[model samples]
Target: MRVTLSLFLAAGLAAIAQPTLAETLSFTLDNQTPNMIVQFHATPADGGTRTELLKKKGLYGGQSRKLTIADGSDACVYKIRAVFEDDSFYDVRDEIDFCENDTYTLAD
Candidate 1:
């Protein structure tokens, strides 16, 4: 009887200790501009200055990268910025719905 009780308790504890899975928003970036390096950033759409995701490692022309936005809430829109090697940049402020699209292409 004691052995059975201990086994039941252990099984209960193990079930309680199981961790929950977290939801994540992810996307892919494709650099189509020839001869230009690319860097990108993802920020909240609420006009705050906090950068939720940044890729400073640089992506060469024709390269692609996958990025994850760590927002677990119901936020579906975000600000995106792409910086080129020539100091020129493109900004999309609060106009992207990341939940519906998973791929972004950077071109001239």
Candidate 2:
């Protein structure tokens, strides 16, 4: 009986130690504008300081980068902003459902 109880306890502990699965949002950025440098930013749609997903060195035309955002759930949305070499910018506001989209492209 002691051995059986020990086995049960060990099984319970193992289950407790297992980590829960969290949904994550992942996507690729594609640069389609030729001869321009591009930088990317991401922020929570509800409102927060922007986080630079890409910085300093920029993505050139025809280049693509893969990014992953963890702890993303259906309840949350994100805003993505793209800055160009000429100081011009374009923003994709809170309209993005990250879980449903896999790629973002920057173009002229």
Candidate 3:
């Protein structure tokens, strides 16, 4: 009986130790000229590697955008860039933190 009680308490304590996560994080970019192209990439802060999210063409002073990445326990950094066919590019980046573990419920 004592061993079971101790195990139950330990599990409850462990559950309380987890952290919560934010709902969303997003960004937009401004392309320099008409019909300019851009690429969106994310680089995890853990020094893993950079992943390409998107590429598109834009109008003058046009916009490039991206949405949610995935439901994962790891925090990551993201970067966006405008790349031209001529090889000229401009980049913007930011980092977002995520919960490694958390108890959550869906919002209706």
Report lDDT per candidate: 0.73, 0.74, 0.46
The list of candidate 3 runs beyond 4 A from truth reads 1-24, 33-35, 55-61, 64-67, 71-81, 91-108
Which one is best on lDDT?
Answer: 2
Model 2, stretches more than 4 Å misplaced? Answer: 1-23, 70-76
> Top TM-score: which candidate number?
1
Residue pairs in clash, model 2: none
Ranking by lDDT: 2, 1, 3
Consecutive 10-residue window with the lowest summed lDDT within model 1: 46-55
TM-score (all chains, Cα) for each model? 0.64, 0.63, 0.43
| Each model's backbone clash number | 0, 0, 0
Error of 1 at 97 (Å): 0.7
lDDT score, candidate 1, position 50: 40
Better of 2 and 3 by lDDT: 2
Candidate 2 has an lDDT of: 0.74
lDDT string for model 1 (1-108, tens) is 999999999999999998755447788888888845555776667654444354567788898888887754446677888777888888864478888999977777
Q: Across residues 8-104, which tens digit of lDDT does each residue of candidate 2 receive?
A: 9999999999877655678898888884555677777777656677657688888988876663333236888888889888886446767778887
- Sequence-dependent TM-score of model 2: 0.63
